[model samples]
Target: MARIRTIKPEYPVSEDLASVSLPAERTFVCLLTQADDEGRQRDNAAVLNGALWSLRPEHTALDTEDELRQLAETGLICRYTGCDGRQYLHVTKWHEHQKISHPTASRLPACPVHEPAGWCGKCKAKGKGCARPAPENFRSLPEALATPAEAISAQRPCTAATDLTPAVDVSAAEAAAPGKAAG
Candidate 1:
């Protein structure tokens, strides 16, 4: 009987070994393939393990000292300066005094809370405060008009259901009924 032999498939080579002897073009291809495989593996692992996976690749094997220095000089990629004078990666400063110019001769300081308020209709109609108005000149008419009317009304409805008697008719009712008390 003839002797039977079996050959096992070789596992994919690590990136370090592939980069060492490959030509520049081949090395790039190998590096890209390795990165893709690593990413897929990491994603699979994350799914299987039920945990957060780092999206940013570990660059230790690919990066040289020069590459690291270059990245460092470019500053933090996601940092922003907050109004509280702190360097934050997520929260940003809101400039409440930012000005918006109208098509006419006006500019208004943007309110951080309400934001733009559609070019201040009253200011546009009045042809004033179109742009960068002085604090003294920044009187907002719409804000004044927005007050609750019920709060400022001079007359309020009587809450007592039994006190339906009109103020002028109370004396007339007492005189007609004789024994009825006037309240």
Candidate 2:
């Protein structure tokens, strides 16, 4: 099964990322997507590069070492030698983005960075991550929101005017009310 992964806003392109070409970008994304829920993977250059290139033969920009170096230089990945005398990688901003409900033991040695405490709504509700039970008011969400995938799939692409009217119609009585309609 595919482990869940996190993707930040600037994940595709950033200051440290812009320097690398498309090949490096693809390889990095592949590793991140295939990594464990904790954003860790074996730091074997040959295996990574071979898998990446084999998957996308057209992407022949950067070699594995060069791509790994780029990722490390950008503070996106941290590679280290484990007690087993093998290298491992850890994405720096993993926890900040991903909320793993079931985290597995990392085979690599610990390289934890101390972070200041912050509010975790789930933690206060006796949960590890955001997998807490919903309140009683749950399932009251509107149909569109409750089944977002179906709603999204049912939508047709609108390439017309940007100032389209609201989908929710306002009754004439409400529209005529004092200060209801803006100037």
| Local accuracy by lDDT, each model | 0.26, 0.59
Q: What's each prediction's TM-score?
A: 0.14, 0.52
Top-scoring candidate (lDDT): 2
Q: How high is the lDDT of residue 1 in model 1?
A: 12
- Model 2 gets an lDDT of 0.59
Q: For residues 2-61, what per-residue lDDT tens digits would candidate 2 score against the true structure? A: 464666787765666677766667777778666766677777767776666767664443
Q: Model 2, residue 74: displacement in angstroms?
A: 1.8
Off by over 4 Å in 1: 1-134, 144-162, 168-183
Off by over 4 Å in 2: 57-62, 112-183
In model 2, residue pairs whose N, Cα or C atoms come closer than 3 Å (at least 3 residues apart or on different chains), thus clashing, are: none
* TM-score for candidate 1, residues paired by index: 0.14
